[model samples]
Target: MGKTIAEKILSNHSGRDTKAGDIVIADLDFMIGQDGTSGVAIDSFRKMEAKKVADPSKIAIIIDHSSPSPNEGVSAIHKKIREFCLEQGVKLYDVGCGVCHQITPEQGLVVPGNLVIGADSHTCTYGAINVFSTGIGSTDLAAGMISGKLWFKVPETMKVNFNGQLPNGVYSKDLVLAFIGQIGADGATYLALEIGGQAINEMSVDARFTISNMAIECGAKAGLMEADNKVMEWVITHSKKKPNPQVADKDAAYKQVVEIDVTKLEPQIAKPHTVDNVCGVTEVAGTPVQQGFIGTCTNGRLEDFQVAAKILRGKKVKDSCRLIIAPASKDILMAMIKDGTYQSLLESGALAVTPGCGPCVGTHNGVPSDGENVISTANRNFLGRMGNRNAFIYLGSPATVAASMIEGQITDPRKYL
Candidate 1:
């Protein structure tokens, strides 16, 4: 009868003994909204006759999608968000501040054992640091904004153990893709994924974030990682709040258990139209590509850029291909510049966009033309994911994207390593 991490966190928030299938009204540590959704949330807030946010400090409004005012319509949304945040005394991250998923963690707005909700589906990204974060619709976002509380049905945990060292050029992205491909898109519906084991324990925080960021792709409620020293150190450095970390008890039960050995795992790719339509890199080798994108909430961290820079150094992007680089945040972009990662990528014919969602949301920035193929590090390959339903999207790791940018096709990343 031991409680999993999710149960323990919910119990703490709700002041009740909680478990899977139980519904609870819990206090939230943080709530977030982005330009794409915040305007609607603001409208909902006003419609509810809510005068003030329960806690302005805990609520954040970020303008990332359609950033820099892609068009007049989006510009009005940006203006509305800015005015709402300013009037409510809420924190606002304007254009170029980075994606909400990346900046929330970067700014230490989330911490271990915290219950968080955002209007964006990738809010599960915070689970890399052991926070119980999930996505909600704009209406739910407004409710949390006004009350600082939300209801939840505690989710059963799914334990995924990753052992063995990841081979060079094969990354956490590949490992997660392989898992998603195995489980299919709806496999973990409404389940909290607890990812751990030797490989995950050894991965850098940035890489771990990539895995958690895509948990939603498999229909997971949230992706949780153990708050080991590495995660603790990250939270300590980034977060001002004292950590209240939690780990699942040894006897805690899981709805399912999956084991993956990464010693020989290869670079994975998710073919167009679905994230779970995946295959080994060799399965689709030599597939022509017109774009190679290496940024998004999923893989726009500093580590991803370093890998891309290393691969593109002393080489050039294919003449027929366009390589687009986007850093996850202004901080990551600055770090890349200090270390020459930015320069390396640019010299190799890669075009650097603002440190935001870029073409991943299909708003502006780097959309591809009709009938083109794009190898990207972003999660999701659903039709029109990159702005055009006619263009195909292939999901891969940063190294895989970089390697493919050179060859103008789907090439194995190990070839560059």
Candidate 2:
């Protein structure tokens, strides 16, 4: 069988012939939505005259975008979601829980060998655990809500084999950036990238997420790494057990292969307004920073905190810069507090925000002022991504972002390491 992880997951769910570019609407195991735009999906649902969600038990609604303190509009949306969930008998979470994907595994919403779909583009982030999850539009969400089935065109697979151990200060973010820089933004359009190799096997799951979360930026349908010991450790440590998700069959099919030699990589930076606009951190060095942030679904894991906490252990941020850090999940937050990581950051004058999609979605918490320039650990820096349309945004690793806060300019993370 020509089977990628996604293919294997989909076949188990719907059991249909799936060739590249074939659209098949199959029953899904899970569906999710969040505070920022989930209301839009719910609104569209009312228009369909579908009284109840297709399978409310399988539906999960999370409120996090404007979470810590939702504005009047977002609050109203939250109330509606509560009503919808109550009426339809679905599961719901308040702001306290954290980002959807983080809590999903924590709550055991994702299981081994399941085909999951979410309403947000970063839905692919769940692929870190071998779940076949992808992003879809709100309209598609509402349709899936009515019928447990969703459609997808089987994507061609690209094998990205990363070999060699990474040198100090070279992050998974750098590796992903270097790959996309070589492939261009649309190089993997309508394609699935199967990332594996010695270097990848050596990486932590948090590092894998940093790579996979930005897969959509490359225009890839989805990006994934073969599940391995690191993946098993993640599920065991977080979910309290191993999931044993199915892997691609030994003879499963792949379309193409790409390779990365991590030993040669250095810190990478994505220039403002487009993820595809890329260069080395040295290219933008000394670009003064007014804001520095180190949280997002892409880089807000506990491992990320270990990087930033070390950089800011005994130092203060530049007088002109505002640095904000948020854990991706409340569980992570609690763990950090217990481990004194929060104190390390607080002592250094780094502000803490609630766990959610903060700043990255331009909704609330930690927004930058107009015309301000900031270096962040976020996945994208498109126009107006952080609040003000004209504000300058630079994307980098957590270490580099923390270093920039200390120096008040874009400093290479290698300096701190």
Among the numbered candidates, top TM-score falls to 1
Candidate 2: which stretches are off by over 4 Å? Answer: 237-244, 249-253
Residue pairs of candidate 2 with colliding backbone atoms: 3-253
Error of 1 at 285 (Å): 1.1
> Compared with the true structure, what per-residue lDDT tens digits does model 2 show for residues 99-165?
8867776677876566777888887876767767788888788888888888888787777888899
Cα lDDT of model 1 by residue, 341-362, tens digit = 9999999999998888999989
Q: Report how far residue 65 has shifted in candidate 1, in Å.
A: 1.0
How many clashing residue pairs, candidate 2?
1
Error of 2 at 228 (Å): 1.4
* TM-score to native of every candidate shown: 0.99, 0.95
